[model samples]
Target: MPRTPTLSFDRGTLILHPPPRGKSWMDYATWDDRVEKFRIPAIQYRQVVEALQAEGSYFSDEAKAFEPLELSPSMEMEPYPHQSEALAAWKLAGRRGVVVLPTAAGKTYLAQLAMQATPRSTLIVVPTLDLMHQWYAHLTAAFPDVEVGLLGGGSRDRTPILVSTYDSAAIHAEALGNRYALLIFDECHHLPTDFNRVIAEYAIAPYRLGLTATPERTDGKHSDLNLLIGQEIYRKTAADLAGKALAEHEVVQIKVKLSQHERDRYNQLIQTRNDFLREAKISLGSLKGWQLFVQASARSAAGRRAMIAHRQAKEIALGTDGKIRILADLLAEHYPERTLIFTADNATVYRISQEFLIPAITHQTPVKERHEVLTKFREGEYKTLIASHVLNEGVDVPAARIAIILSGTGSAREYIQRLGRVLRKGKDKDKFALMYEVVAEDTSEERTSVRRRGVKRSEERGARSEGKVTQLEILPTKQITYGSGDRTSQRAAESSGKWDDNNSLETEE
Candidate 1:
């Protein structure tokens, strides 16, 4: 009598003993000389099963440890038109792909709908602890009967529905490879990193859903999401849903000039850096060129001086006195409404916070303190807040009507995220959100503003472009107010009931 073929999970890979006699299984298997058997990656479990079924091969599937789930959302509400369309597209694509919807456009609700449609053991991977907790709260409220556990931030409960951070998931990917039948990646753009990619590669989940406002990465690794999750089955920009799912918005650019003394020092620093670049035959025009400059800057004294000169020049451009003066004017102008001030560095964040007496948040802020600050901001206690890159992604920022960008990077993704902080609609449906970009005249900051808008310097003032901006003709309405509080807090208060139409779980990411 011949022995039956057996399949099992080991660490993050699949093991097949007795050597299944078929081309389908052989294609994914490698001969393990030491184990005297064939080994396959866990990711190929679905493909291998399908191929074996087609070939009429018999094998015991002992690798899958997850079971079916009977989940029904406790809340009763209708999804937005875009959410409906995105969900339909994901279903049509065999329930495996990415959905690109702007923040506050209800990507979380769409994920809930997908969960109901599939009803399988699921694991959700987020980029931050704040998001992990938010998802845990939302999921627990949506499914009061289901067991929703967490696998990050010091807790490691293994329920049918799990929410985990990227770091935690990556570290334990091997043990979790076969536990979930469905995987959902929030802010899935983070999935393509070398360390996080293994989380997806090791999982045997056949169904996947990736959600993000911006999917492009500065490193160009976003392309890896195609193979890691699925192709982008559906996408909608903030401009695409403006005035319907989001508040109507406008972007205003203000250019300020440095004082005579500041300009002289800026010129001297820029000249030093320029001379070094010229001598080294290096350019900062492209990513490669910038990388080469960084490599060259670490080799000698001249390189170190050049690096210092570049830093001083950037600081002057990003934090000039003129920009500070303009910021004061804008804050006073938009003082009646909630405002968020964004800067490129923490030093400038502290400077503006202390000078203006506004509350600030940086990476150095304690988690409990950060939560309190955001709570106060949401309750209308603090009308203005300043922050560095800490609030750019993963934090659940309350809805604001005005955003002032003092300085930032050249990444379009960052620009989109900052813009999204103010796009959520509140009690006033007619109100239009405003984003003011204060750029230093004749400085590198001006070029960064243009680059971040996803346009060339010549096209900075051109008509609205895709994924960049929306042109609204409506005038700003008088001080928009959240009736009781921001939509996030309202949803948190009424977690067991229906969600408000104007707001869903809107994270910065």
Candidate 2:
């Protein structure tokens, strides 16, 4: 009888001995000098096993040291139809793939169903400490008898069902690679970056699931999710769930002009920066051009001055006095409703917090204090909450019916998430969720606002093609209007949707 091939776990990979002759697995396996044998990436464990079995070859499998799990956790509520559909799609993909659903669509419940269905030793990776604790509490409640552990947020218990932060998982992936048979990446878009990629590739889990509201990344590495997790098995935008699952919502863009002094300062700073770019023949439009500018700036005094001017110009655009005035008026108008105020930086967040006397939460906010603020906001103790990038992703605020975007980047992911913060369905179904994007007129922010809203249009088109409709309305200034710097809304909606800069809002199907 021919010798049965053996497999063993190496450093985050599987070592295959004797190189199964004439097998198709040779395409991915490489020779390792240290072991004097063939090495296979641990991620390929499923493919290798299936190939060996198809070839009728016996193998001693030791790469997977995780024990099989059988769990039937009780649930208080059943999965919704779309949630069921998402779960079924993931299952049909061989229990390994990504599911893209907008926030507040019960992704956590879908993940819970996956855990019950697979019933394997699983590790869940989240982006923030708050989310880690949230998942921990949910899992512990769902699996009352099962041993659940947390690997982050100053906790280091290891149980069959474990929740960890991305940082902690990245640090301990190698040691914990063979300990779990399933890996769940919450907010999976974060996994495709440099250091986070290690956590995904280093795990030996054959069963993987990635969950995200917006998976599109500006860096274009989101495509790598196909290998790191699996192909996108199912995707549904917020528009797809509106009215039925989520609150009816509308995105409104408001353009405001900087004060005279602010405008003068902005123009002067922009001129200084533009002169340097013109002299260096560098374009800020492309990543490479921007990178070249940064390199040039680091090497000379003129370049340093240009960098300073650029920063000042951006500050003036994002933090103009007009924006603050508009924000105050909106806050007063929406005082009866729960609101969320978002900014791009902590400085602006704190400024709004102080000027408006609203509580703020940024990365600098202590964890306990952050939780208190969220709790107060949830319990109606505070109606409005201000945050920078911290609340853009996961921390839930279900009561918010209004969202004010004072400042942010042009990234569609950021825009979508900020919009999602107030999209959760509430008691009054007839009420519309409102998003207000405040843009500085005629400055670089004009282009930035256009780019961000362009992202929304792309998603709107994508959703429309998929048989869902979302509305975008451009609201003209109630008091001040300099110029409609970018008329994208008017042009893009000309054929199908009409432009309504007037106060009359249009709700799409």
Candidate 3:
């Protein structure tokens, strides 16, 4: 009598015993001398199973530890046209891909539709604790009967449906790799980091969904998402759904000049930094130039002076008095229209907050106070709020019609997110959102502004020229059902259709 071949899970890996006699399993497995068996990464579980089935190899699958769920949403709201199209595309892609929709376009609701369509044990990974809690609340409201648990911020309740931060998910990816049938990564751009990538690589979940407003990463690691989650199956920009699902918006750029005294000091600082760089034979134009500068700046007094001069020059460009004066004028012009003030640094945020008597939020702000500030902003108690990068993402900022960017980095994602703060359509459907970009004239800030906006313009042009607008199809507003078992049942589901402000509190994380 011969022993039966079997596949089992072990600490974020798949183990094959009595090694299947074929090249298919070998493609994904390696000989393990210690266990006298073949070991495969859990991520390749789906491919491995399919390969074995294709070759008529019989093996007992003891790796999967999830079951089909009968999930049904309590609410019966109809999905927007774009949302419907995105959901259909994801399904057509075999239920493993990314969906790109602009902020405030209801990406969360689309994930719910996916859950209903597949109805399996699911895990949602988010970048921040705030989002973890927000998803928990939404899931609880949508599925009153299903037990939704959280696994971050010191709470570790493991239920059929779990929400966790990227840190927590990555920390326990081995134990969680086999527990869920579906994995949805919110703000999926964070998935490509060195630490967080393991969460997806270790998971055996054949079904995956990545939701993000911007999928491009500065490090170019976003390409890894193809292997980790799936390809970008669907995408819709803010312009695509403008005036229908979101408010129509416009961006205005304002250039301000530094005073004579300021310009003189700025020139002196720049000259000093350039002298040091020229002597060191370092060109700031290269990709590694900045890193080289940092390394050289720490070894000697001249290097330290050069670094200081570089910092002073940047401060002059980013925080000039002329920019502050223009900000005041803009605030007065747009008085009381629910405005948000954004800056690159906390020093400028606090400066504007104090100078204009507006509330400010930074990473240093306590979580409790931040919540209160946002609540007040939503309720109209606060007309204006100032913030640094903390409000660029995750925070449920109140709907504001006007956004003023005093300073920021060259990141296109940052620019888009700041613009999105005001793009949400409010009760006044006819209202259009306005964003102002204030740049220092004849300074590096001007170039930074162009670099950020250039990427956006290129994206919009590509979207328009390629005609990526998805035609909407009406889907039935009922729970979708699929068969049981892991691989076979997943294929069956693939065939189916369906789908701020300031406040202060002192809390520790």
Candidate 4:
């Protein structure tokens, strides 16, 4: 009798023995509303893999297996009975939905518990590459035996369980959609947009899950999430997450008066612009004239540079520098093992990192280097790290004893991401610290915050509304039952029983 072998795709579909791969998976595989996502055939995957391996790629089959860092179930994970109950609820929800637990409420741990309870072909999608690696490390530890693959940071694998960056999955949505039985979106609020909507539309995996500290969308398309991806199933706010499994933190809003010199400079610009508008008869009516006047002020290269400098100077006068000093002092006072400070601009992050004795992290960081920096920070080699937007959303930093948001809130998305930074729970008493928002008296940014925060509040209230429906994502109901030993080991063992041998790794198409 001929022995049949199992086959899988980027999406995690299993065939007892699929026919020899045919077309490039991109043609019929897409599920775009306007233009569908692409799908590649199994033969395409095999060819790509072989080609990359021939080139001696880093992720090739020739690459030796990474040493396993196994986690004992008793040591790191002890799912609270309540958390387990939520997992049970999640299972009953058909494994499709979002869990909105407040900052520091142990949401990552919740995800871990869910993984343990409903282990299957899962893909955890995160917003940043830092998070991509963070998830990879954590999931690898949780299910050490599973042949988990990574799809961002220049690495891709065909393992049953995978962790990927939002951009990577979104970019390759058509090719990867049909491969997974389960999909988990972290910082799920960022979904249903340019980065995630495509993924939602293409992949037909039966199970889905999204997690966020704040589930409100920045682009005003959460309803799209409701329609496209899944529903917001459960929510627990920071006020609630605190004192539960999370830390009890304080928020300090420090306001700094603009320096006299900077105030005069600001006044000059405002006055000049105002006078030009009046003289040019462009009092918000003549759009062309208004643009011309502003352009005239920016005529000289020096003036143009000065205009930018003025804004930066005003920003420093208003908050960032003063806030930096304050942060340094606070870090000294608390000496938190892991503290993260966020800035709206990259320059601000750089200046703070240079001036203060803290490390900075951003998207520009190579994936592996970022891993080393964070690992060092986590193990207490460093006490503080500065971030520009990157740290605001998805990378799990359970060691973040304190978080300081020195700037931003332009969009509700910004606010949510910044606040979510400190929410990962630590050991001990789970004490958490969060210092958020510094406004310049009556700046437009302040007004925007009110609107965004209000909208967030409203949406939360509607969660109990029967008329207004929230999204609930379906997760795979079928658990990875009848498997023993570690996940990675099990997969390696499965390799011996399967049709493919030493061909588990995936290559780019």
Candidate 5:
């Protein structure tokens, strides 16, 4: 049972229904006294609030009469042509589907348009607390008459528009699923595997729209989402959306030579991973090992340890001072201007935050604090902020003028999400975005980078093949292989999708 915290409403003397534990003489009676200084321990206040909602405790004559606030006529902001087109697509796509547009393309505006178009009780799932604020503010501003409730890591309310975090929504999905008429999943790509998807299953909202810059998964599968949310109706690339409201950007692939010491540590970690992969393969013959490996890596301490080794090794190669130096160049050149630095680990985030004397945000940061920090960042109070993997997917930080990726989780989904940070439209310039990836030379970082680029390059090709987006130019197919101990060049990387087996390791087959 949740012990209600002592809350002050400035108006009538309001008292929480159920008082906290350790209640002595006065907390015993169920009195309606308004003004009294009291303490309700904060430890499990959420539990108390959740229990109140679960028990239907908040329903009352006065509670129901609080009349929802409404938006003024002057609050309406017209959508751009593309935004209007996206709205048309959303309506035409029937009920449930996902929209792939670059960051800063006014997806929230589109959602608002949908709300007005359909005008049903809607539930918006956000990934972070800051987004909860962003969603509530926009919805409230757009629909001043209606109330917007927020349910994130902590806050949980149910107004006309219920904005929630994905994690919390999934946890109590059985309840939230039935309540809303429409479900709008913002930053939809972050939903990975069955953990989060289970919420979508319970939802009966005939209307569903998912928003993402990159809809593909890190594992390179869109089929799961294609099943839950319908086919991606309108797909717009960052390059396609750039130079308008969004930024036109350049990606600089900064290669850093690893120090011998770091190289030695990285090499050892790779050997362990490769060795484990081999053992798992031998144990589960053919390609069944991949499933077992994934399962093992999913829950076991051993698997987690191995995964850490993989990331730590990659980070050593990727986040070295040499790599940081390259990233620093981007940050320094644009210093005094807003910048976002992303890394694979909290340690690296902390290191950069301390080195530059800037603020940092991670999952470990308190939810309340995150909202404040993001607000400050948006107001340009902080010029630079570094984040561990938390900012990779869904949260929106509007003032990120430049982005630096010193280290990454090696997820193509994550890569695209990190890149999405700076693509939001800016007012000062033609909205230029600078994406810097500091990769260590001659290591798996190079391999990972190639594979990641290849995935995007391939998807763009796939999109072209599907007759959606056309390639700027197509060159004649060509392949070149040098003599012994030489190299090979392939014209198109679309074929790289399949990994060659049989003699994949043969020097000369």
Candidate 6:
């Protein structure tokens, strides 16, 4: 009998001894000149093993050493219809796929269900410490008998079930690659980024699950999730669950105009920025235009000034005084209602917090303080919370029915996540969820507003009313009141008339 090829783990890669020559493995297997053997990334351990087995090639394997996991019966919780549907779809996809369910739709619970089904050593990767801790708490509570580990936020305990931040996972993916049999990515849409992609590619987990409310990215890198984790096996939008699984909802757009002095400064700054762009022959319409602008800004004083002007123009447009006034009125109109206010930048969030005396949570907020703020908000000690991008994903606040988008980017994912913060069904069965978008009229924000709403510019115009709020009723079964010209309604629409049919405002010129 001849000696058959064998596979073994070496550092972060797999070593193939008596390397298979003149075979299909040649495509992925590379000659390790130093070791005098073929090497493959540890991630391909399972793939190569299956291929060799299918080809009737006998191979001894020692790459995977993870322990099998068993879910305690106490850990099981009855899942909702949609959650069950998502899990069924994932299982049908060979337990390696993505689940696209709106936020607060119990995506985390679905992950727990997956753990029970797979019953193997698992690693859950999250994006932020807030999420890492959140998962750690949930996992520890659910699986009391199982030893859960953490690999982020200064913690490096490894157990049968593990939770880690993307940064930490990327830093240690190789060593942990063959340690888990299952991998779960929360908010998996972020997995396609430059360095983070290594976490998925370096893991040898045979089973994978990706969860996200919105899997589409502006950079189109989300498409890579098809291979990085698996295909999107199930998807449900906010609309798909409204009134049944989620609260009934409405989206209101209130337009406002800038003060005269502000408009003058904005126009001047935009003109200055455009002048530089024209002279430098930089067209922002191109894909690489922003990159070009960044590189150019680093090389010349003129470019630096142009960059400052650009920032000023955006601030003036996105943070207009008139919008602040509108926010005040909306806050009053929804007084006593649990509200979440979202802004484009931390400065704006802090400004709102200071002016309104509301609690603010930014990345700069200490973890302990942030937790205290969220706890108070949940306990009704605080009726409102203001944040810039930090609360857009995974924070569950079911009591919140009002969301005020003072300012944000045009990304649909951002808009939807913010909306989802308030979409969770509450005890009030008839409660109507509301989201107010205070947009600056005749500014670059108009286009952004349309983009964020995922509506066509022409359709938006068709529904437009001069200075009046445009209300979109998301649930067909629900009827709510925001009459066109009521006193409070007028207050909401005051000065909005200037937004009339003009749509040519440019942030650059």
Q: Lowest lDDT 10-mer window, candidate 4?
A: 500-509
Q: Which stretches of candidate 3 lie over 4 Å from their true place?
A: 455-509
Model 2 — TM-score against the truth? 0.88
Q: List clashing residue pairs in candidate 1.
A: none
Write one digit per residue (lDDT tens) for candidate 3, span 79-183. 999989989998999999999887878888999999999999999999998899899999999999999999999988889999999999999999999999999
Worst lDDT window (10 residues) for model 3?
A: 500-509
- lDDT tens digits, residue span 1-509, model 1: 88889889988889988876787888899988888889999888888888888998899999999999999789857778999999999999988999998777777889999999999999999999989999999999999999999998899988999999999999999999999989999999999998999999998888999999889887789999988889999988877788988888887766666778888998898788878888998767666666777789899899989888888878888898877878887888877688999998999999999999999999999999999999989888999999988777766554688999889887677887888888877566776889888776667765676567666544433333223342221122112112222222322322222222111111112
Estimate, for each residue in 206-244, the C-alpha lDDT of model 4 and write its tens digit. 567787766665346876666454677777555555566
Poorest lDDT segment (10 consecutive residues) of candidate 2: 500-509
TM-score of each predicted structure versus truth? 0.89, 0.88, 0.88, 0.64, 0.68, 0.87
Candidate 4: residue 348 lDDT (0-100): 78
Cα lDDT, model 2, residue 154: 82
Tens digit per residue, CA lDDT, model 5, 1-509:
55444432212112353443433313323354454343222212223344545655542211111222233433567686777877788789775688887667778888877777777778898777668777888877777677778887578787767898888888877566546667798878766557787567655455788988767664545677766666788777666666765677766655666677886887687666656656555232223444565577777676766667765765676567676566565677897778888877798888878887889999898877877887788898988888988887657766687888776644555666677788877565566667777666555554455444434334554554454532321111122222222333332222333432211111110
> CA lDDT of each candidate?
0.81, 0.79, 0.80, 0.56, 0.63, 0.80
Candidate 5 wrongly placed segments (more than 4 Å): 1-74, 152-156, 171-179, 190-195, 218-227, 264-312, 454-509
lDDT ranking of the models: 1, 3, 6, 2, 5, 4
lDDT of 5 at 144: 68
The residue-by-residue lDDT of candidate 6 on 1-509, one tens digit each, is: 56667777776788888765437566568887898889998767667877887777777787787888778846675677899999999999988999988787778889999998899999999998879988998999999989999998899987989999999999998788888889999999989999898888877788999999888887889999988898999988777788877887877777676778887998888788778878898866534776777788888999999889878888898888887778888888989999999998999998889998999999899989999999999889999999998999768788899999888887777888998999887576676799888777557787777666666555554444342222322221111122222233433433243432222233121
Q: Cα deviation of 253 in candidate 4 (Å)?
A: 0.5
- Candidate 5 residue 276 C-alpha distance from true site, Å: 7.1
- Deviation of model 4 at 230, angstroms: 1.8
Runs of candidate 2 with Cα error greater than 4 angstroms are 1-3, 18-22, 426-431, 455-509
